[model samples]
Target: MQTIYIDADACPVKIEAERVATRLGVRMVLVSNGGIRPSDNPLVESVYVASGPDEADKYIAEACGPGDVVVTGDIPLAAKCVAAGAKVVKHNGEELHERNIGNVLATRDLMQDLRSADPFRQGGGRPFSKTDRSRFSEVLDRLVRQAKR
Candidate 1:
């Protein structure tokens, strides 16, 4: 059966993903490093990994496979999931398929390089907006339905 694995550390659409998964009768696993409260919903399982970098990401990557959907903002993890044949979505609902994964990965690496090279290069990303959340919900809903089939 298809499952939705969420890299929940910095994800903003946890609740939205849960709602969609519950409605679609799909299983959703929220993997974190222990700060998130476990959900009471039986369909929603919270897997708290050891406190370390990429522990949750490793777990999710190992478990996810074809027909599985993963939600994450980490570009490396997204690429891993995609290579494993799972469909991946960003927090803002951007789908990262095989066709775009390479470009996305390269861009992310480039951006990281720029940041490291320029310590004074200020400016965090924009705050997540309602429209972004709405788009995520819609895209997640569609992906979940497709995975079910």
Candidate 2:
């Protein structure tokens, strides 16, 4: 049984994720640090971890294993999930597999280093768009179908 684990701390696609998981009949777990509302859907549940920076990430990683799907924007968490044989999808709907995890992690580290070096540096990432939601919906549907196989 493949489950969907979401890093809900800073994720912007919770509603979309819930809708997809419900439609796909996959159990969805939203892990957070107590900031998110509890879901009423029996298939969707929210797991609030202890208040810590990486507690939510740790819980998500520990709960997922092979054949599971994880949605997260955290590059390190995505890399860890991929290494654990779980499929990872970014909030932007990009899939991260073994082939590209290294490059993603490297780029994330490089950006972190740059930010640390220049305190004034800021991330240039744009706000999530409707296109992103559409892409995510399509990719998530595909992934759910694949997981059922």
Candidate 3:
């Protein structure tokens, strides 16, 4: 059976994922580092890791394999999932595949380096919108169906 793995520490699409998973009768796991509430839904399980940077990401990556769907905004985690043959989708609906994972990781690292070089340098990111949620739902449905096959 296929499972949906969510990097839920700072993910904004947890509710969206749950709605889609419930509708599709799919199992979902939310991996966190001790901040979110545990889900009461029988189909949804929460796995809390030790409170440390990247602990949740490590757990999520280690737990996922082929035929799994991982939702994460972290570029490195997304790359890892893609390399593991697991389908990866960002909360904003972008699909991460082998073709683009390297570029994504490089861009993320470049931005981090730029920010670290200058304390006052501010990195800009767009806020999640309803349209993003809709796109994610649609893409997730498609990915889930593909995973099932």
Q: In terms of TM-score, which candidate is strongest?
A: 1
Tens-place lDDT per residue, model 3, 22-82, is 9889999999887789888899999988988899889888888888999999998898889
lDDT of 1: 0.93
Q: Model 1, range 76-147, lDDT digits (tens) per residue?
A: 999999999999999998999999999999998888889899999757788889998999999999988787
**Stronger candidate by lDDT (2 vs 3):** 3
Reference-based lDDT, residue 73, model 1: 95
TM-score for all predictions? 0.96, 0.95, 0.94
Q: Pick the candidate with the highest lDDT.
A: 1
> If both were scored by lDDT, which would come out higher, candidate 1 or candidate 3?
1
- Model 3, position 3, has a per-residue lDDT of 92
Cα miss at 29, model 2 (Å)? Answer: 0.3
Ranking according to TM-score, highest score first? 1, 2, 3
For model 1, state the Cα shift of residue 111 in Å: 0.7
Question: In model 3, which runs have C-alpha deviations exceeding 4 angstroms?
Answer: none
